[model samples]
Target: MTRFGFRYRARRRVLAAGVLAAAVLAAAGCGGASGSASSSDGTVVLRVPDPGNSGVLARGKKDGSLAKALSAVNTKVAWTGSTGPFAPAAQQINAGQLDFSQGSITSAIAALGQKPGFKLFAQIAPDKAGEGILVRKDSPISTVRDLIGRKVAVNKGGTAEYLLLKALEKEGVKPDQVKRVYLNPAETAPVFNSGQVDAWAVWAAYSVPEISKGKARFLVNGDQVGSQNYSIWAVRTRFAEEHPKVVQAFYEYLRERGLQQIKDPAAFINVFTEAGPQAFNGAARELTISNLRQGAAAAPIGAAQLADFDGVARFFADLKVTPAKVDVKPHVLSLAGSGA
Candidate 1:
């Protein structure tokens, strides 16, 4: 053959080899590095969010415990962390892009208002100190009543907004009394620090750093204002129905690990904070450890938890935070206990 002809034949052979390899992988049911798929070997790949790099699932992924536990039930995890607001996470779950994740009950209720995309499998008790409104330490706003007429940043339709609403109600302040600046967490952080917003209704992720640095203080914590919020784990609705065992196994593992972490926050600090990109340092790290010690832990979904979820849904609906009313009972799966 001529040199050009020989080169053409070599290229064809290489292309054929690549095609064969791809077919082999497809036949094995490999769903790439991050997604939900089942292999011929009876292993199920489940896609889940990383939970801001400080949640149970993130820590579970850092160590081998999560995988090892799931292996017994023939399930694998794919940590496909989400970016941006809760709406995106809800959209992903609705579109079947994610298999499992954890978020506040407020977000879950908002998600259910649109469609039956996911189901609550387990719950974490109220982290009273994990969320609240924050103001500069030297700010004049010393009481919830003082928030009237001041600008406060909150992620609309989220825990922060919920907290702010409840706080205002507690203080007899009308919804329109305070200026609600609808800003996301990232936006609220810089604005709050720069004194553009009088106060920011936020979660521990943003508040802890500022508090630890002595630049901010909590105007009102969830506990102080009787927050009924709960942290919940959700599985894709169809996925949960299709793979109940997998969901059960993962929930049990999370519950076990979460309990352990609650008992000894230091033991899992490395995995929760040091292993992820959003790791905390210095005063923030110390403050995180302290908070975790007193924070909530994973628990099996039950009647009481469902009742609280219903209350949250009702509250959001009544306040027009959610589009319409949602009944959370139908959207939850009581795997380990009675949740009716």
Candidate 2:
């Protein structure tokens, strides 16, 4: 089918899917109201999910930064693997499988609309360098427009998809022209390496490893498109509302740790790279440092940030990634002392 024909058909199907999803979510109540309570042993464990690659928690845990902060509050921190798009992790958070989760702002927004129980409370890296559509070093796909009728891997509903869509928009490629293969960060590399996918739209840890190996080259990067990328930490609303102290202390810890990294980029990069994601070695080191240097220091998520999130939500809605416009403010956790 022609690109125009495919887009026309996909649009109709997407609209139907969006409506059905909305109706089902409405009936299902968008989850929440079931987050796990404090354990019987009187221990408060906060389960946090990461994108399985950023190594943010790893650095903190290794350096005892997290231990010091959580210990002071008598809270136990558990690191759980939450690779890929992170929509699953968000759903896990809604189902009470997780106390909190963090990832691409796109997934958080999508989850907010799909599942209502969670709240976005903190902003993490807005780093955009090294994030882009990567193609085999010798591949014929030389530019964004070269991807038409090609296969590109992206984690649907996550930052990968958002960047891919935005890139296509900028390049004037119809959405249906490129086939988007959905895969998690862990899964994407193998598939991309084996020539299973023509290209990959990914960021930071995911894209850096491959680029360092000289296995692929950027057809275009996130910065080339514009630096709108951001990751956020979110907790279950009930958790925030009920255990304000824990939430406040948690974000405070994150903000402090973030500042520490910014204050000493060289030391931070050395620690993060050597502590053995091991993928960040070789040529990847320079890229990693560049991204860290460009990364946003963790900070409170507030009005201007909320407005940016809301704008992204509208972008998703127009593209039918979400059922309709979502006013993101309702789901933002605004605790009194939380610095959220």
Clashing pairs counted in every model: 0, 0
> What is the Cα-based TM-score of model 2?
0.81
Worst 10 residues of 1 by lDDT: 1-10
| Candidate 2 per-residue lDDT over residues 199-234, each given as its tens digit | 998776566667778898888887776646567777
lDDT of candidate 1? 0.70
Question: What is the per-residue lDDT of model 1 for residues 1-340, given as tens digits with 9 covering 90 to 100?
Answer: 0000000001011122233334324443443323356766768877764444454555676778789999987887665533234456566666666666666788778878886678887777777875789999999999999998899998778778999998998888998999999985765667898999999987776777689889999999988888887877778777877788898888777777777776766555544445333666678767777777776666777878877888888899888998788898888787845334
Q: Provide the TM-score for each candidate, comma-separated.
A: 0.85, 0.81
Model 2 / residue 84 / CA error / Å: 5.5
Which portions of model 1 show Cα errors greater than 4 Å?
A: 1-36, 51-53, 82-85, 272-277, 337-340
Residue 133 of model 2, lDDT score:
83
Model 2 residue 151 CA deviation (Å) reads: 1.8
Query: What lDDT is obtained when candidate 2 is compared to the true structure?
Result: 0.65
**Clashing residue pairs in candidate 2 (N, C-alpha, C atoms within 3 angstroms):** none
